[model samples]
Target: MKTYQDQIGNVLGLKKTPLRIVSLVPSQTELLVDLGLKDSIVGITKFCIHPSSLRKEKTIVGGTKTINTEKIKTLQPDIILCNKEENTKEIVEACLKIAPTHVSDIFTIDDVIELINQYGEIFDCVSKSSEILDDLTNKLTNFQQFIKGEKTIKVAYFIWKNPWMVAGNTTFINHLLELNNFENVFRDKERYPEVDITKRSSVDAILLSSEPYPFKEKHILELQKKLPNVKVILVDGEMFSWYGSRLLKAFEYFKTLRNSI
Candidate 1:
């Protein structure tokens, strides 16, 4: 048997080729299903709601950060998939104690493509993964063309509401913003940080995400009132967060979003 590994800390040890797998990250869980590993996936987190039909068939382990160790052990996964950002270090350590685990840490488009290739190799679906990657690359290129020479709009992308946290420089959201000719106002911040409304006034736009906190249309009106000059838009969280096959469609979405802005 051979073993394979990726730069993002994901490792695939070929013993029996991972017949039963558990995916903790919602985005990665969806990616596995996209890669045609639906039957091989035995367990998923309660938060993995994409491909809604899988919700009925897959065993629910728990959330990404917290999992029922006993229940996961009972399912007896040959391989466990987790993400560094989505799952805590403690959770990954606990999962490793039960089975061979692969942890992925992604922050850029390149990292996402590499992850797709790695998953393809592990799941024996390289051609499909390559095709998906090609589609994503093309979309991204087109998005770049569409946004070329556009003024860099200063934008604050809020992920949470109460504490008012906005995506910072190091996150994938920040990268997407840059791709769309939008300069992240909080580039000085290392990660997602709780921001003050007064400080947020400088941005030209306020982007409210549809997940993590499910920012709704009403929230847009609320934010618009607070920041009258800034354009408030409801953005799809998956477009910025999924980092997999979903990225193929995200560029076109971003293009439409840019036009709307």
Candidate 2:
């Protein structure tokens, strides 16, 4: 058996290469497929909807936060893929009982690239992983050029609405916002801070995300009533948050979003 360390530096002692794998994160699941490991995946969460064919091919082991331990045990995966924020500690502990669990802690683009390289070593797909990394680098470079000379837009991104929460500092969403030259007004606050939108300060734009809570057109109109002059648009949550293979398409989306606003 050889040892492999995940992005979180958790050393996993396993065989030369894992045959059966379980993925708990949606973005990472898509990344695994793009890395040519689709055939090896035995279990995945219901949220791993990317590639569109995984649902018919793999065993559904429940959602990201709530996992079925029994189903996971039956799959007997040689390795389980998880994320620090996506999965709970209890789930990680339960997963360890069945197989080696590789937990990823992603916060920046560099971290995503590092995770790709780590997966390359863990899954014995170094060449394929390098190719994906190069592609992502090239896309991000072009995106950098696309955003040149664009004035920074101070914005507030809404992910949930019941209590009114925004993507705060030290989050992957905030990092992407900065990449697109959009300044997050709540950057001073911690992760996912709750706020009273009615009493909030001024911002150039208000972004409504399409996930976790599915902020829709009606919601946009409601926020518009409060801030009549501010630009409010529905943003693709995947492009802003999903930090795996989805990143390949995100830069283009950002370009379009910037142009539209």
Candidate 3:
């Protein structure tokens, strides 16, 4: 038996390769499936919808924040995958009781690369992980070069409406914005918070993400009416939030988006 420690300090001890698995985070769950762990995955949250086929076959334990512990216990997974920010502490504690759990906490690209390497090692798919990481790194480098010396565009990324929440400093979206050479106007705020429209006039662009609330083109038109000078764009939420293999294409999408702007 060997014990494997992930970047987040969770130990995965197994006598043999884990045959039964459960995933809590939607992005990581999709990554597991992408890594060819489909048959091995016995349980997933209702929100893990990347591979639509898994929705019917895999048992739904619950949502990301609220998990059904009893249903998960019945499935009897040998390994459970979770995220530090997505799942609650109580859910991780409960899953630990049923199986060896690996928790991932990722913020920046470096952290994402580390997680990809660690996942590869854990799943005995080191080559695949390396390939994905290399591709992502190269693409990110190209994106950086493409945007080098470009004028910094001050932007505000809105994730929610009604209360009008904007992505702030330290968030993944903010990091992605910086990568694209766009300065987040709400960086002064500690985290995502409801923002007042009066303060948003200083930004040159307003980006509405297609998640958390599914902001659409109509939303952009609505925002344009409010802030006539600022350009409103509908951005993909997954490319900004999904910190897995999905990042491989995120840079290209960002480049196209930048061209549009």
Candidate 4:
């Protein structure tokens, strides 16, 4: 058996490359497919909609926070992919009972690269993964060049409504904002925090994300009324938050966004 340690230091003993794989994380599911493991992935959560075809062909165990244990058991996967922030401890423990589980804890671009490398080894697709990493590295380099001398705009990125949550420090979204040269107003706070929009009078712009809560044009207009002078724009949540093969396109998106602003 081959022994591998995941990002969180959990050791996995694989008899062979995982054939019947189940992915609980949406971004990781896309990465697996990009690594040429689409057929190998037998199951996924309902949120794994990158390939689109996977939803039709693959068995969906359930949502990210909730899982159908019976459905997962029925799939009889050799390996299960999960994320520390995305999946509950209970789900991880339960998955371990069925097969070797690899849980990734990603906070930065470096961590994403490491996860890709780990997947390469885990799925025996080193060349394909390396190609992806190379492409991502090149794109990020270009973006860095593109953002040089760009004015740093103070921004607040809203991920959810109702309670009004903003992506704060120690998040992948914050890291992306930093890369884009945008100063996050919530940088002092940790994780996603409930924001008092009225108190945040210093922000130059309000970015409404297109996921988790699906912030739309109507929401943007409403927020615009709340902060009339501030620029309120609808941002693609996937480009800002997804830390996988999706990152291949994120830098390019960032370039365009920054250029517009």
Best by TM-score: 4
Candidate 3 per-residue lDDT over residues 224-260, each given as its tens digit: 7878888889998898998898887788899888888
Q: Deviation in angstroms for 169 in model 3?
A: 1.2
Q: How do the residues 153-242 of candidate 2 rate in per-residue lDDT, one tens digit apiece?
A: 999999998899999999999999999999999999989999876666769999999988899899988988888988999999999999
For model 4, how does the per-residue alpha-carbon lDDT over 136-211 read when each residue is reduced to its tens digit? 9999888888899899999999999889999999999999999888999999999999989889779888889998
**Clash pairs for candidate 1:** none
Task: Quantify all predictions' global Cα lDDT against the true fold.
Answer: 0.86, 0.92, 0.86, 0.92
Better of 1 and 4 by lDDT: 4
Per-residue alpha-carbon lDDT of model 1 for 1-261, expressed as tens digits?
768775655565767677899999998988998888899999999988889988799999999889999989999999899988899989988998999888888889989988899888877889888888888888888877888877888888889989889999889889888888888989999888998866655788888988798999899888778778888889999998888878877988887888888
> Model 1 misses residue 178 by how many Å?
0.7
Clashes of each: 0, 0, 0, 0
Stretches of candidate 1 above 4 Å error? 6-12
3 against 4, candidate with superior TM-score: 4
Q: Model 3, residue 120: displacement in angstroms?
A: 0.9
Clash pairs for candidate 3: none
- Model 4, total clashes: 0
Query: What TM-score fits each model?
Result: 0.95, 0.98, 0.94, 0.98
